[model samples]
Target: MTERPNMETRTILRVIVCDNDIRKIVLPLKPQTVDSLLEQLEEKLGLQYKFTLQFEDPDFNNSLVNLTDIADLPDKPTLKIVSLVTTPTPSTADTEILSVASDDPCHSLRTAWPETFEIPNFPVDVEYRLRQGNLQYMRDQTYLQLSGELKHEILEKLSETIYSYKAYPNKEDFEAVAAALIKKHPCLTQPGSSKGWNGWYDSLRWKMGNYRSKLRRAGCLEVSINGGKRRGQQPQRNVKRPKRFEINFLPNFPDGEDEASMESKRKEMVEEMKKRRLNSALIAQNMNSTFALRRKELIEKEPAVKNTVERWPALFTNGQKSNVNARRTAVLHGLPLLLGEDPTDFYKTCFDCDSNEDMLDTAIGIMTVIPEDSPTVPYSLHLDATTTAIILEGTVVVDNLENVPQAMCLLFGLIYALNLEYPAALKSTFDFLQRVILSLGHKSLKPKIQSLKKSPNAVMFFHG
Candidate 1:
């Protein structure tokens, strides 16, 4: 009997890698998504996967085409694969310029040739990246050393002067060069050097160094000099240098006037206060406050406690001592005794007086988590229902809350602010609050706070 021929059917698929160029890759099986393919490669090859992908026609024979551009494909997957060979197309950076270190003036001019020159007319900004990736970014000194167009411009100004060399004299040598130049041109004064070659050289050096330092700080100039010497490298030609000079351009806020400017400014102050309050509260709650007592004589006589309940009906106005939100919430929460005070007024007497600075100073001493030598001192924050709302409004800005005198001041402030409308009477409550802050040292709360502060990332509040 004759043997029967067997027939089999298979779906043909091809893998193409998107890289400097596209190349076909033999994928054992078509992956459902790119992520699965990377997982398979990582597991099989024990390599961290990172690659761009494309698909090829089932036929697999031709100049490698970009499979990613095909209209029918779904979204690209995250899988990376290696095994794909590409005919990497060299970009403009592939062009090479051979150099023979010659003292010829032409060679000097060539040194000034920027690694890149922008084509202003081009629809898009175009730059020439040098083939030598490790070439140092040339400095202004290097460019000035070259007698190029820029050099010519400098030389023209000094032609009448006896100074022949266009090079900038070193600061130590500048006076000598200026004296010699001034003798030849009676019109040229020694002070001219301040704005002439010497001055330009010094200014350029300073600016370039500043610019390059900025680039390095930002990690933009990662390409090392000569591959890894870690020495000074010039910025690639035409690359914009990073800005380094600092000048305050914005209008300065007056001292102590947390006067709400725009809504944005108000929001910022509110948020800052809330964080301080929270930190203070947490510190206060954990203290051994049983021994804590207010300095009795320091307490001022109390005024008639205003009934704030009816005050909720009043519209927010300037010069009011209470914040609108504080009063409204107090009334809503049935805390009628605390009503009628404006919360936003910040202070009825002196606006700039920091009522909480003393508390913050105490917090710095009480906070053991913070090194006594730490540059930033612990700060005390005062928050009420409105202020607490400000702190938890978005995110906690303060980082070292555990080092605070009372970490839960924020919580207490929030509770009072949220559950009761008018803040507890300021004078008596602040004294009481101080005692509460001292209570944070109580043994029961210390560990809980330590655990909170020591957590790798302890966030006081999460933003919605």
Candidate 2:
């Protein structure tokens, strides 16, 4: 299937405040209509600057509205606003609708907080106390009321789940928890069957809707996960080989002037220069480097590689030496070897990209590259804020045989960078480190590395 390009779309205007205490605008506005909006915005911003509009709609194909197209917006004019986020009117539909018994418990809790607590005369006694006639002795009897305990409990649980998702934001994990809750505690999880409160079941539904909405609004929410079981059938395995387009060069290049051209010309050269076969082309999209070369290297030293394999047969096992060898192989093959140039920078890129796999990989590679080093490796590698640098104190786990060589190569690069001051060496070490981390999963390694790099005492860890 042909991939759809990002579409142009509009979103609700959200006002943001920057560190400079200046108000800034983020958009999900229409291409043409937003131009008019920006006219109003520039007047509001009181500055002459270019702006970008990102598409906020998840369902839409393209969602960017560039503000560069706008002509002259008034410098400073009366800013008439349709939506000002004040304390919302108490009677607004959202407020009124949310205040009802059918609304989310969190919303309800906010609206009718301490409903019972505010009334001092109301009974705080349990059912057992009431049955024992404990209140009979009271000279002034007050109306007995049950606690909103059930409502509060359900709300707390739902809030916990949503919060957990926000922190980690894994759809599969979130859905699994949601599903488990429903299966095990149907009263609380089901739409309208919870016991105790007047509209207990309805409240659950509201919580579900509310939580889902909050997550969706956050923008990183997964649509498939929100749809429950209605999501389509599981995607089929992608076994079809990507179609390779051939380009025929001019006749003069038949023998190919250079070794590179000659290699291209030799149809039989395909056999000699074995192409690195990616697990899937998609893997290439995020991989910092190619596994093809690494695989090729393994194939090349069938004899020497075989000897090493035989001598250190344990390298194939889960051992430090094995891990080192595996990492070396990965580096030789061309997988990235570093966490990134600057942990913070790469992190922001990843976060801004919203975890777009391809962009994230590129960002990670860019951010982790040792900056002082150039030519050998370029500086200013991209990364996001969430990127971390791990300081492995003891042993590191090797997930596969391939990781062994890759780890060894990474260790060597790290050692080389440690004693040396070459910018290129640092870049190479960072690249090597990143590839090693990538094998486990990008999310796992980013945090550790990021923390160390950001610290003022970043030098101490080298010896540790």
RMSD of every prediction? 30.5, 24.7
Top candidate, metric lDDT? 2
lDDT of 2 by residue, 135-183 (tens): 4424333322324774455455655444322322333433444454434
**What is the lDDT of every predicted structure here?**
0.26, 0.30
lDDT tens per residue, model 1, 1-464? 97543323111232222111122233445455546655654454333224444332223212122334424333332221323221111110111111222332211111111111111111121111111111222321111122254333333333212111212223433344334332332222223365444643443345434443443343421211112233674533332211222111111122222223323332333343345232221111111010001101011222223422121111121211223332222222221112222222121111123243322222111111222332221111111211221122223323344312233354455545557332333332233233322333233433434343332111211100
Which stretches of model 2 miss by more than 4 angstroms? 1-153, 162-199, 223-274, 277-464
> What's the CA error at residue 140 for candidate 1, in Å?
31
Q: In model 1, which runs have C-alpha deviations exceeding 4 angstroms?
A: 1-30, 38-49, 55-61, 69-202, 209-464
Error of 2 at 442 (Å): 43
Worst 10 residues of 2 by lDDT: 246-255
TM-score of each: 0.18, 0.16
